[model samples]
Target chain A: MNHKELIADIAGKIDLTKTEVEHLLDIIVDVCCEQLEGRGSIGMQSFGVFDVKKREERLTVHPTTQKRMMIPPKLTVNFKQSSILKDKLKNVPS
Target chain B: MNHKELIADIAGKIDLTKTEVEHLLDIIVDVCCEQLEGRGSIGMQSFGVFDVKKREERLTVHPTTQKRMMIPPKLTVNFKQSSILKDKLKNVPS
Candidate 1:
């Protein structure tokens, strides 16, 4: 489902209008992004954890040119599914 | 940040109260989990994609006993970040 559809679904589940739900979602995304940019992590008890992972600088050979280069260390967002969601997805009984 | 703190952050940015924000966040999580359980995927334009991936059953050996075993096929929640979020995370000027 796309953003609108997802928001509509959530709106259906709760007593909120679609627009209000959309705005809230946007705010959630913005807050999460800002937190990640500030080098923080967010954890949802039932969903998962979203955090920034730092990659180490490493030497790598170019696949085509065969030239070795040093790739700078960088940050990327990572997520680990929570056990609740995992069990739900796998349909395994806890 | 924990769920409460994150919701508080979002609440500060938007008009919603902290409690309302928490409720919305919960609704979001519930909807997403239901979607995944229903074998569906959710895409947020500015954030990322959440989808369920199916793992095929495979044969593997236990390292300790060296006994062969079959791993059952299962479902997992996977996420792929959007370019917008990735660029923000990498600080790429685009």
Candidate 2:
């Protein structure tokens, strides 16, 4: 499901209109980006934690030309599934 | 930030009341969970993708006891950040 579908599905289940759900989703993404950029993390019960991790600069060689490229350090968004969520997923029948 | 804090923050930025934001967040989490449970994936631009991955059962040796453990096959929730989010995080100065 894409963003629109998610919003639509969620809106159907909740008491909010499509527009409200859309705005809520937009705000959520915006807030998460801002918080992560500010070095803050988000934690939700039974879901997961969204964190910003610092990655060091690294050198990579081009696969085709054998040329080296230097990648700069950057912050990365990392999500760790909660044990509850993990358990819930793991128990699903194949 | 925790769930409450997230709801509070997002509510402050949007026109929705705190209660509405809280409900919206709850629905978002619920819908995502249900979709993942059903082996569906959710993707959002400039954010990330939430997917369900099947993990095969594996044998692992205990670190200190020299015992082998059998990990059962299970589903896992995987999140892949979008390229736009990645670059935004990468450009942050150390």
Candidate 3:
């Protein structure tokens, strides 16, 4: 599902219009980004946690060129499924 | 941040009350999970994508007992950050 579909699905379940749901989604994304950019995490019970992890710089050599290069340390966002969600997924026949 | 604090933060930024925001969040979570439970994905432009991945069952040895065991296959949720968000994070000083 894309953004529009997700928004429509959400709006359909609630009393808000599509536009209002879209706005709400945008705000939620903004808030999440702000929190993650600060290296913090967002935890929702029975849902999951969104966290920011920093990958340390490392040295690697090109496979073909055989040249060494430095990879700068960078930040990344990770989502860990909550145990509750994990259990729910486990219960589904794979 | 915890769910309550996150909800309050979002509520403060929008016209919606805390209760309304909480309800909205719940529906969003539910929709996302529903999509994921079907092994589908949700893509939010300039934000990221949430996908369901399946890890094949594997055999492993117990560390202390040295006994072999079978690990069941499981479904997991993964979030891949968008390049826009990655760039934004890169701009932040480490």
- For each candidate, what TM-score against the reference? 0.84, 0.89, 0.96
Deviation in Å, model 3, residue A25 alpha carbon:
0.4
Error of 2 at A41 (Å): 0.6
Name the candidate, 1 or 3, with the larger DockQ value. Answer: 3
> Pairs clashing in candidate 1?
none
- Using DockQ as the yardstick, the better of models 2 and 3 is 3
Q: Candidate 3: list runs displaced more than 4 Å.
A: none
| B1-94: candidate 1 lDDT, tens digit per residue | 9988887788889877888778778878988888888888899979999888788889999999999999988887788889898888887321
Q: Let me know the TM-score candidate 3 reaches against the reference structure.
A: 0.96
Residues A7-93, model 1: lDDT tens digits: 888888988788888877887888888888887889997999988888888999999999999998877788888999888877732
DockQ for the candidate 2 complex? 0.71
Task: Give lDDT tens digits, candidate 2, residues B45-76.
Answer: 78999998888999999999999999988787
Best by DockQ: 3
Model 2, A1-94: lDDT tens per residue? Answer: 9989998898899778888878778778988988887888999877899998888899999999999999977777888888977877765777
Give the top-scoring candidate (lDDT): 3
